[model samples]
Target chain A: MLNYLWGAMIFIGILVAAFTGNMAEVTNGAVNSAKEAVTVCITMLGVMSMWTGIMKIGEEAGIIRSMSKGLRPLLKWLFPSVPEDHRAMDHIATNVIANFLGLGWAATPAGLMAMEELQSLNKHKERASNAMCMFMIFNMSSLQLVSINIIAYRTQYGSANPSEIIGPGIITTLVSTAAAIAFAKAAEAAS
Target chain B: MRAISVLSDLILPLVIVYILSCGYSKKINVYEVFIEGAKEGFKIVMDILPTLIGLMMAVGILRSGGTLELISRAVSPIVRRIGFPPEAVPISLMRLVSSSASTGILLDIFKNYGPDSFIGRFVSVMMSCTETVFYTMSVYFMSVKVTKTRYTLAGALAANVAGIAASLTLCQYLWG
Candidate 1:
């Protein structure tokens, strides 16, 4: 009852916004928001580019592969469905690493690429595979260790110690990932 | 000085160019496109300005009508019992509602109190970890046509619980 109620609340909220001449406003907001989003995207570009360059450097330096190799055991545990040597696992590893640094913008493309590779491995069309479910769960939980966007916002708003959130970010993500993984496995088991 | 001035002008708008390039190819003249896009952008701003005002008013009502205050008050005891300072309650609640806006508010708190301040650090941790569960669930479920699911609600709420707990623990230990 409560589930349906909350769903209705959201549906109705979007509906009401659409009906009450707020559609124009909503559309406008979406566009304006898009513009602002563009600005933000731009702002993040250099940051992402820097990180991507660094990641590339790391890759060339064999650091990323080593990190992925080291993370293999844990990644295998977290994603039991993916073959350890699968290309999807590598993309997932890169995606997870990028996300941990709070590089959401960077992580997104990597995540999509990971999903595409994962999909290639999927034989079922109607029902999601275990890998798909785990991917979605992990993406939603998004184990952010640095929370770069928040730090950027802090800097934008004149924060004196914008980088201070890193510790908490790391801790919270570790906890959230553990919980998410546990719940996801439980759901898989129940199903 | 001339080179410095030229370089400075180039620096700020770099973000502008990079953003436009993301959705489109590099071959296009980004500056011209951005300029052309600004009119539509301005129109969008004008259109949404009223709604933005309304949203702000709604937020203002929550703030001034004392509902927000009451919520913080109600949650304070529970949070305090877990070792978080009372100041974290409001910010945590707000973060659940909207991350971008909460980021602004969190920045203000960080600025005023210093990031190492107990409450500031707690809020920081909270900001880093949590998603806007209510908003995301609402949007995702609606889009996906999921009209029934008690477990989904429970699941989302559970994620929030884990987030908050981790936030408290980390802030108290490492940042404490």
Candidate 2:
């Protein structure tokens, strides 16, 4: 899927640039974006490392376990296919918590681990399960309690009140999350 | 808003203190475990570097080639009918596929219209309210080797649409 999407993007970009006589801009964009990608990763590394280290202490100290325990009822409701005591639930809870806190860099590792754990429980090797689908929906539209990135950007751009959007952000994300959960549940029932 | 900002600032410190205290009480070597987790985090970043680079380049070409502008123009009429500023069309569209590209668009909007402007606030809210659907789907499914996504994409895109609609409506109601 990604292969085809990536190929088409590059191909169509070059073709369009040729017709538009903007090949030079395209060349510069490609080079600059490639460099930007590395810079982005390097920036992410510091945040990711710090959060993951704290999360490690959290896990070792059983904070994560307690967090998962508190989240069990909700997790069970969301992923009925997975057993209540499964490790995937813990990872899912951690991922969702990280996402809710607007710690996307910290969420990826736990989200990946959750997917892997869910995959292991799958009877079908190549196909994703209903639980996995629901998890993805929730993660994608996860309710953000605080959007640190947007606030930071607003501050950088010289907004008078950088955090004013928190109210609207929370409301919008809640709406999206509700929509995602409803859609996923409907799809699950239909199938 | 000030209260929320203060709370957000305290979250990191609170988490760190809680974790360290818990680890101490539990008689665990917090430093070693933290290093182990940090190593895993570094590994994960390394693993995703190639994918990130590929996506960035694709997004760059699409933006520079003027395809995004064309699409934005094509969608402007409908978007305008819905009361969303036509300038936001590009950001909303690119947002589904690439975070950085959409961010670039948002910065442009902020530059043209100051961050306190209606359109600027709308874009900021939208950015916070949504996720990069294609990027998340690709990276996650690829990591798990799930070739058959089985409605995950549909669900995510649906949520993205909901997010955009909600942001637009909320922004108008609250700030317009």
Candidate 3:
């Protein structure tokens, strides 16, 4: 991690020198890029707020609870160590649900709380348990439903159809999540 | 030309050649295909609503609870010394909360200060490659009830370092 940090610093330093040599263009492009990013971010906030509202409605309508019910079986398979009545299951459901909708912002705390709960169950204090490994793997490669940020970026970059990455995003996530899961399970077996 | 461009961009010409060899029908409607593709995106958003909300509320609670400050303080000095700005600290913390939100905020940062600024480059690169690993792992682990691992923090932080490196190098090379 420290190595990467140093590399980034060195890289940025060179970029600074290069841009300074051509002050006119670099400054202009940087300004334009920043401007575009702000516009896109503003638009994204609107989208995020709208989704957040809709999700609230879903919760009020019992939609989320029902969805979690459906996910329970799969959760059981993935986390057999957890007792049937554990709160961790609920947290997992919520976490997966958030990822499914590309509402990653919403999922952070639930992820943490879930980890705390899971930690309570751990017998070992120094090493990560198998379940911990599995959980990390899944989270790392969690499938995204919206990929909204990328779309916004594409728009910022002047792509004709900024949302066009959705198909590829879905495909890539599916592949990555499956790979992450496979590796995690394999590790569990070896351990 | 439009149809050719869409088909060429999305699928390999060899596949098109195979379809043609197989006596496939004449030209397809590019607009229709595009719409169909976009509709799939809408469906995905619809399908994930509950999870998104629960996750958000949980994060909202954590934020309200002031956990981000604690996490930020621990990582601040290292990030700052690397030429990343102090303001970027919260955004990076938010990233552990959510990527889209983080990106949205990054845009705000970029607006206030150009992307070429020391901070802007670091944040942008951080945005490009890093996943919200800590938040995701925290939730997943908590849900399953298997805790007590230190490697997760290490691995995730390491990944962020790599992402920062990649972003900085690429942006400087391409935009700088």
Candidate 4:
């Protein structure tokens, strides 16, 4: 998906620039943007490191596990078919907790694990079961507690109040997630 | 806005303190553990660098060649009629495709309009609530080799639409 989009963007950009006689500007923009990408990463490196470091502290301190424990009831409701003792339940809880804490690196592995475990419980190998849809909907709905990266970007760009958006972000994400749960259940019921 | 800002400002500091205290209570070698995680974080940034560069270059080319403007202009009237800032049209669309690419568009937005601008805050909140729907669904569904993902896509898109609308409304009531 991204491959075609990336190719089209570059191709259309140069072609359009040629027609507009702005090839020189496009050339400079390409170079500068690449350089800027490095600068942006340097800024992100500090924040990402610190955030992950702190979250790691939380992880090792067992705070992350406790949070995942708190998420069990919700997970049970979301995946009613999955047995409570199933490995998939643990993976799903871990993934949801990782995502909530913005530990994306941690989430993907657990998410894949959860998917495989769910697959093992699948009756139809060719179709996504209801549990699978519910799980995917929740993940795609954005269950994050904070927008760390956006806050970092805002800080880098010199916002007077970098974290001001955090409250609104949390509220907005909660609303979307709630709507996601409702939609998932409605879809589940209709089918 | 004032109340929310103060409350929001409390979050990070409180979280940091909480984690440190938790680590201490657990008798963990907090410093060594933090360094270990920081190293992991460093690797993540390294992983993102190439993708970020590619996205930046692509978006930059699109922008500098005036193609973005052409599209933005074509959509602004319609967007304005819908009460969405025209500048956000591209960001929202790009977000559904690639996260890094969307970040590029967002940074462009922050540059053209100050990060403190309404459109800037709007997209920030919107991005916070939405994910790369097509990318996530495709990857996960493919993992199970399921060609027929019946209601997942619809449910996900429904969430995104609700997210966009919710963010837009919240931004208007709070900051617009």
* Per-model root-mean-square deviation over C-alphas: 11.0, 5.0, 13.3, 1.3
lDDT of 1 by residue, B45-154 (tens): 34434433333333333333343445567788787676767656656766666654454346445544666567766776777777766665454334333344334445
Best by TM-score: 4
Top-scoring candidate (DockQ): 4
- Best by the lDDT measure: 4
lDDT of 1 at A6: 31
Per-residue lDDT over A86-166 for candidate 4, one digit per residue giving the tens place of the 0 to 100 score: 999999999888888898988998998899999999999889988899999999999888878898888778889878889
Q: How accurate is candidate 2 locally (lDDT)?
A: 0.79
Per-model TM-score versus the true fold: 0.57, 0.72, 0.53, 0.97
lDDT leaderboard ranking: 4, 2, 1, 3
lDDT of 2 by residue, A1-191 (tens): 55676788789988988898889899888887777667656755765666667677776776755666678888889999999888998899988877875556668999999999999998897898999999998888856666655665576667898768876777788889999999999999999
- Candidate 4 chain B — worst ten consecutive residues by lDDT sum? B1-10
Interface C-alpha RMSD, model 2 = 5.0
Comparing candidate 2 with candidate 3, which one achieves the higher lDDT? 2
lDDT of 1 by residue, A1-191 (tens): 33353344235434556444444444443344334444443444444444333333333334435556777888888777788888889888877776664444456667677766766776764345666666656656746655555555455445566555654566577777777777777877887
List DockQ, one per candidate, in order: 0.12, 0.49, 0.06, 0.81
Candidate 2 C-alpha lDDT tens digits along B12-128? 567679879999999999999999988877886687678777777876787788776677788888877878787788788778877755765665566558889999999988888
Question: What is the lDDT of every predicted structure here?
Answer: 0.56, 0.79, 0.53, 0.89
Off by over 4 Å in 2: A1-63, B1-73
Residues B1-176, candidate 3, lDDT per residue (tens digit)?
A: 24423532564334324323332233444334434434443454444443333333333322323333344567778875764555667676566656544654565455455554555545654554456775556555555544565455554554454445544544444334
Ranking by TM-score: 4, 2, 1, 3
